[model samples]
Target chain A: MTYQSRYAWSVLFRLFHWAFALSIVTLVVTGLYVNSPWTNTVLEGSRSFPMATMRYLHFLAGFIFASAVAVRLYLWLFGNRQEKFWDSAPITPRNIRNLFSTMAYYTYLTDRHETRLGHNALAGTVYLATIVLTLIQLVSGFYMLYPESVFWQKWGVALFETQQQARFIHHLLMWYFIIFAFFHLYIVIWNDIKSPEGLISSIFCGRKFHRSSS
Target chain B: MTRHLDKSHFEPKLSRRGFIKGCTIAAAALGLSDEMVPRLVEAAASAQKPPVLWLHFQECTGCTEALLRASHPDVGRLILDMISLDYHETVMAPSGNQAEKSFKDTLEKYSGKFICVVEGAVPTKDGGIYCKIGGRTALEIIREAAPKAAAVIAIGTCASYGGVQAASPNPTGAKGAGDVLGMPVVNIPGCPPNPIAFLGTLLHFLTFKRLPELDQIGRPLFAYGRKNHDQCERRAHFDEGRFVEQFGDSNHMKGYCLYKVGCKGPETFANCPAVRFNDVDVWPVSAGHGCVGCTEPNFWDTHSPFYERLPGVKIPGTGGIVHDVDSAGKKILGIAAAAAGIHAAVGIGKRIVKGRGKSDEDV
Candidate 1:
């Protein structure tokens, strides 16, 4: 069996990916602490605002995460074919069929599997959904952060109606990301181990090994 | 009725000195500059007393009680004298036909000149039959009166956000005054909103001849400008994470932050801490109880289970099985872990089977 090394991801895509991941991880940790600070460490004589500091960090990371996601969205719309928006389109009949086949392979109901570059149909669908969820998180977060601001008070309150609802949605979606991360990590590792694709390394090096022969 | 009585002759129950002192204190409480003290006093003493028609609907009359229990001994009298207080069902000596006559007379006497103070939620279900005043539904009376008034103030959580009456399965379809009147209304929302907030708003309006600045919910910004947590006395404890685990525990006795025991101060926007209730140095948190978030909309339904850190999310159509954030998160995480474990097992099994098949072919 012969294999070809192909360029799969852009440098910008890798940078954004890592930045988004780091920011999200930091956000989740600090966000949870902000919600219910379980730590009781009192740095006596320091007079530092621990909760406030955590909140500021959370907000800072939130901005970074939002910007990275926005860049990723822009790249999706106008980047090269390998990184274009259509790569994640899961609406076509062929894509739907491919999704079911992919599910079957995962479930061990199929022996043979289709070969593809970039994301498979199911992964594409999940990524699209993730983009939507990230957008929701960003809107809700900014709304809660500046509920008193005139712009948010006028528009965000109209859309979300209350800060409590926005907080609820934001917190709930954090769990979704957590669960998604678990499966995402497992699948990437499993694919790398099961195939000669270097799936995990591809994210870092922007290159993947693909079978040259049909 | 001495309708044209001068400020000196008004409300003998409140002496001029007491009224002036109260006005100065109220001016300070309202976040007005010290220079505004004279203006507040002048506004209070003005002969053209703005008529206030206080309306009652589906309510507990707690707001009126709170006002009566104001810290200043003469505050009630001062408020009554400052505003004409043409009609209030709770305090008025008249009842039955006489009260109705008084309300009607006042409405006619001060048409487009009076301030409308609504103290309860307005029911819209079943022709607003839930609350009736003088054989007239709340909706009907508000519709007839609200448009005629120069300014309308909803003076409690009930009047602001439908309060407890508009909780889940709200049978009467109760709504806030703003929603029912289809106009912006100044809302001073609390289970029993601080009397100073009401007084401050009314005084600002009287002094400026315009409504004070309001938030999105039409609450005066001076009083409802900051979060309760922002101004909480125990916020330092919150920052240090010294939380009360349970009511009457050691932490509670130590006067730590009540966040763990379900204090809604962090999310609730109010000035309860800055201006303690009854002008005494005591509010809910200071009195060793978590804030129930009485000022926010639909608080009764949304900010309940007062002992929990966060309100439970009710899954729609689940017949009220509420899941708190942690539990729901844990469930998802548990499922994800289980799924990952099972997948790992399946992947290992597949790999072994493929390896054996390859070895057999090689043999």
Candidate 2:
């Protein structure tokens, strides 16, 4: 058998990935602080505005995060076959079968893991869920940010009964992102080690290794 | 000019200057410009007093008490004079059959001309037996009277969205007046709503012959449009993170923000900080306590664990067990971490077992 290397990710896809990750990290850190500000500044009164600064950063990062999501969504619709939603996501019947097969590999029911050029069905399914969650965050975050906007209030905020409930959903979803990060890191690293593919580096560089018949 | 005014219902001490001053305040509260003050004065002096039928149900009468305590326009007296309060159970001199006769007479005589002011929730469970007045259930009375009135005003949180009585496990199945009547009503919502808001709404109605612009929840925009946090005196402190850690803390004494001590000001929509209560330049936050968020819907359930910053979230699959988001987030994260660890361990174990005897061909 010979090893073949394929260029998998577009430059925009890699940029979106890193930007999305960084924004989520900043948002989670700043969001947690905004929820409960533990840092106390020595400067009193109008001299320093810690919460205001934190909230501004959160809102700023939120916009960047939303923009990153928008880029990914655009890619899902119009990018390469590997990057497209219908091709990558486990939506079609063929992909559904691939999902069960991938699940079998993860659960140890199958010894030989099926290698795919793009995302395996299970990973794609999880990515789909994360995309959905990011959308929820964007909607809720925007609603909370612009409380007085008639459009947001009428449409976005109306979905969540109150501003507080919208805030609560946004906060709760942050935990999901955190947990996803933990599992995502572990699984990608595990796959990199277990398989011949340089799975972790593939995200940074656009290349993945696959086995070919000699 | 004021000689015919009933001495009991109109403040005798109110000079022409005071009346104009009251009208100016009314104009301001109604979100009307200075140009409208003269019109307000004219309406106050000459507009035909709209007949009002005030009903009581499952409430504390705090709304009435707050109205009575209104001093800016002497709103207590002003309301009595500006509207022919034909049947208020609290202040009406009559009782028993006479009060019933008055409610009925107003219902018949004025019909679509009279305004209905409901001050409490109506119990809908078991034939509305939780509260009764003159052998009629609150549900029955509101159902009968609301359809006939020109407009219905729900005067407190109880009447607006069922307040405390409709909190979790609401035994009486108490619902707001709008819910009972199955129609929209102008909601002036607060634990005990600022009487100025109620008076402003009434004056705006009397002046314009229509209800003021209402919010998505049918609350008059002048009073319920802006959030308490936005209008709060401690907003600067909140932005600066100068929070009171607890009651009677040094920060509390300094009148810092009450967000940390479970102030629901951020979510509560009301003009409490701006309009104030009892004619004093003070509100819950200004008086050194966090806002209870009495103005919003289902506040008792949604805003409770009042001393805490956020309401407890019911854990999924815990059969309605609720925990604050912090601890719940931690627990969920921990579980996810543990699950990931176990899954990684199993993957590692499988890989090791495979590597022991097999050629790495499967890889």
Candidate of highest TM-score: 2
Off by over 4 Å in 2: B1-15, B316-320, B356-363
Question: lDDT by residue for model 2 over A47-105, one digit each (tens)?
Answer: 88889999999988898899899999999998877898987688899789889988887
Q: Which pairs clash in model 1?
A: none
Candidate 1 per-residue lDDT, tens place, B1-363, comes to 342233543445788788887787678778878888999998889999998899999899999999986766566667888888778988888888888888898889889999999999999999899898777899999999999999999999999989998998899999999999999999999989988888888898999999889988888998887879889999888776677777887777888888878888877878899888764667999999999889989777667776765678777898888888878888879988898899889867876877745421121
lDDT tens per residue, model 2, B227-284: 8888888888878888787789787888788888889888777898888876557788
**What DockQ would candidate 2 receive versus the native complex?**
0.54
Candidate 2: residue B200 Cα off by (Å):
1.2
Candidate 2: Cα lDDT at B88: 91
Docking class of 1: acceptable
Candidate 2 lDDT: 0.84
Interface RMSD of 2: 2.2
Error of 2 at A50 (Å): 1.3
